[model samples]
Target: ISFNAIDSALSSLKNCQSYINSGMDVATQVALDLVESFNDEEDVNNMEKVMLEYATMDRELNHYIKAFEETINQVKREKPENLPDLENLAQEKFLEMESKNSDLDFQRNEKYMYFKDQLKEMKKQYHGNDTIEEIDEDIAVTRSQMNFICPITQMTMKRPVRNKVCGHTYEEDAILEMIQTQKQKKKNVRCPKMGCSHVDVKGSDLVPDEALKRVIDSQKKQ
Candidate 1:
């Protein structure tokens, strides 16, 4: 028979044989060595057989390192609104890997570490910053999902008022005071939220006095 026929027979035998049998141990061992040893087209036939069996014997043996990362991405895409839940998942997986990974030099071990560190940092940035949290909370409330982070500053905001449109809301009180000043000038002003420059006529009419009006308006806006 030709080398091709012999190669085909070996491939078939590798798949047909039971890996656990005692007599087949030597064959399995040789197949594994061949998988790692050969580096030519002629070796491809044997290599495929060896790899298929290895994968069949242990499905996760080659894919263990990527499991957590895949899981993280899956959760993030499927349920972005449940950021807290995602955060918990990240923490749980990170802790589990850290506790289990005594051998940091392993390729899978390093990947796990890297994934865990990234999750921790993202969680911290999401939770620690107040502005970001407020915006996230609002977005979560309205959209029932959270993806709003300042592109430039990475801050969470709620009804993020830009300075260019209606000036800025340096403080709730400051905004209130601005409304009072606008009223004094006979130019009714509205909340700067939503980038609108329009003064609030209903708001101006609601207050007993301009000073009290500003306070009530500020409270309503918040």
Candidate 2:
């Protein structure tokens, strides 16, 4: 259960990071869009203010991600008996990440008001001038092809399950069957990966890795 909590925390952290990166990218593009609308000194000053706000938010998000990573690493090193305490710590960090996300949203809204006002003024000045052309900044993100493969079956994973203890991933049915087989022989269930340190793994040690599943689905579509 503690390992599951740790995995949950890790997933949350990754999600938060993805959000922060996307938000910052959008913020930067918005600033660029504003800058392209006019060349006036006042407009540039307003754009700088908006960019500064985003920069502050970016820094905060980076700090939070770093702190969360450190915390997870520390917890991973702790003994299995200490897992309950680790779960509590993970929950606290998740809450803190949510709070930071809220703070970033507030800052974004506040800065946007100034940005909107500046845009309005710019429109007045360049009413009939050539409109700014929208730049196509949508670059496709490339993922590792290996991520779609199941470590156990060495094929594309359907219904992927992530191992909470060692962060390895596998096909859900394959891992469950492995657990059951071990149980029937009255032996402890351990990770099948050679040289993997994880031991005494149970059915509860696995969780659905939704992110990986999404990636697999997307790749299939393409």
Candidate 3:
């Protein structure tokens, strides 16, 4: 039978006990007397068998009651008045993560810009006098300094991807495309002259002056 039916039966049996003790319910007294006689009899039935059944039922009833009580307590704990809105909590956490990401972006950009400016200045000062070897060495040093800044986002790259063609690596796709694409049909488009032998750094490398000029031209034409 169902738990509710069993519970109801047990309750009724308890009520019957009161009536039996008062000697008011003849029916309940007869039933009780018959059960007691089983224990008193020498050969009718074993008392141990009845006691084992009672113990097993009692344990099962205890488990059901404990389970029901736990469920009620859990419901109370999860009520609107007691618990916070999970969606709102998740939104707040997301905003917190975004703020942290933004802060990192800002700091990274600052460092990257500083190094880029320094490299540009060095390039301008040493323009056109050195042999291929010296120029390559200087370019290598400048590009190495750029490692401090992210090439794509102009932030300090946490995980930087280097360009196979040009030695210059950036985190942004726009910059990389500009560097890889030839500025004009006449000028040779290639990765940075850092002796890296990168054929074409289209992936994430910053576009050189040639690509920028072509972009400007394309924009003008449009």
Off by over 4 Å in 3: 1-91, 98-194, 208-222
TM-score of 3: 0.22
> Model 3: which ten-residue window has the lowest total lDDT?
207-216
Regarding lDDT, does 2 or 3 come out ahead? 2
Residue pairs clashing in model 2 are none
Comparing 2 and 3 by TM-score, which wins?
A: 2
lDDT of 1 by residue, 112-156 (tens): 222222222232333344423322221111211223333223443
Model 1 TM? 0.17
lDDT of 1 at 152: 28
Give per-residue CA lDDT, model 3, range 124-162, as digits (tens): 333323322332232233432334354345554433344
lDDT of each: 0.37, 0.58, 0.38
Misplaced by over 4 Å in model 1 are 1-170, 201-222
- Models 1 onward score TM values of 0.17, 0.36, 0.22
Q: Candidate 1: global Cα-lDDT?
A: 0.37
Ten-residue region with minimum lDDT total, candidate 2: 135-144
Better of 1 and 2 by lDDT: 2
Q: By TM-score, highest first, what's the ranking?
A: 2, 3, 1
Q: Global lDDT for candidate 2?
A: 0.58
Which candidate number maximizes lDDT?
2
